[model samples]
Target: MSRTLVIGDIHGGLKALHQILERAEVTTNDKLVFLGDYIDGWSDSPRVIDFLIELDKTHDCFFIRGNHEEMVLRWLTAGDDNAEWRIHGGQSTVDAYQDLDIHTKDRHVGFLARLNDYYIDEQNRLYVHAGFTNQKGVYYEFFRGMFCWDRTLWETAMSLNPALSKDDLFYPKRLTLYKEIFIGHTPVTRISETVPVNKANVWNVDTGAAFKGRLSIMDVDTKAFWQSDPLHELYANEKGRN
Candidate 1:
């Protein structure tokens, strides 16, 4: 049966991306929901975007706008290159774009601009680069800094006492809106794990593809996963996400 594969942050690690797709045995029928950060880490940001653009033409792919994508969109459209963005792996993306043709650069900018902040699929499975703000239930409206930058949802989930049952009122209401909530942005490496980390109903799939860890892709419904080689090994000479 066809499956929905949710991918984690891909901070310009093109080689890792390719490897994970192959390792997962992704097919044209599979729906690839990417929790974005497609650019800005390794040296191949432009190449990575180009590959994704092509992938979209051939596969069912949904791209969620990430914090990095937001920064890049601002830089492309408004000439904003604040230190906050440039220092955090954004310079590599800028350098990568410098090599693209004018039309190709515009295409990339359009792709980034069209990315959604979050996607709730038919199964009510939420896919986002970062967790959404939980006022009470799910907030569909874009909450400026929350969608692509918030970690509170994940933090809360991580703090949940596994001893409590799902029926426990101690569980946050936000988690009840969906069957599963898949996110990226916060890498699992922070917890010393190089694989997807699950807490409560939240699954963080970013295994730090831009750093020392690997790129990850998981079957959302099945919880089966695939990972690429470590970023350092994938790009032995490049300084990755810092």
Candidate 2:
């Protein structure tokens, strides 16, 4: 049977991406939902975009725009090379694209433009790079950036009381908005988790590929996952947004 795979943040670790894809035994029939951060950090940022553009041709792939990608889009369009972005892995991404031909560069810009802020599946599963905070859910979310930068959704889920049931009146309405929410951006490694972490209805997939953690891809239905070698090991020669 075909499967829907939800991937975590990549942070330009193309080698890690390849490893997990192979280990997971991905097939043409599988649908890929990438949580984004496709660029920045590691040396393969540009090549990673190249691979993703090609991958979409053969497989069903949904790309979510990450905060890093937002920064990239800004830079690509208006040359907004702010230091905040540069210090946080944007410099590497910039350097990676320095030699690109105008045509390929424009194609990448188009690709970035096409990224979705959030995607909701038929099963009521919401896939976003980060999280949404509105109690009424995505449609009512006032700031679209929340989809790619918010942490309150995950924070609330993590801090939810174990005794609190969804049926309770005190239940967080945000959690009730969707059947399940898959997000990345904030690395699970910060909480010392080496694997995907589930809190309430929110599932965090970013295993910190931008830092020292592994890249992860999970089968949303089964919750079974595959991970690559620690990114630090894969790109031992460079400091990847560390």
- The candidate maximizing lDDT is 2
lDDT of 1 by residue, 128-202 (tens): 888877655456545666889999989989988888877887767777778888999998899999899999889
- Model 2 residue 5 CA deviation in Å: 0.4
Looking at model 2, residue 40 earns an lDDT score of 93
RMSD of each: 1.4, 0.8
- Total backbone clashes of model 2? 0
Quote model 1's TM-score: 0.95
lDDT of 2 by residue, 1-242 (tens): 89999999999999999999999999999999999899999999989999999999999999999999899988998988889888899989888888999898899999999999999999999999999888888989999999899999889999999799888999898998888999999999899999999999899999999999999999999999999999999999999999
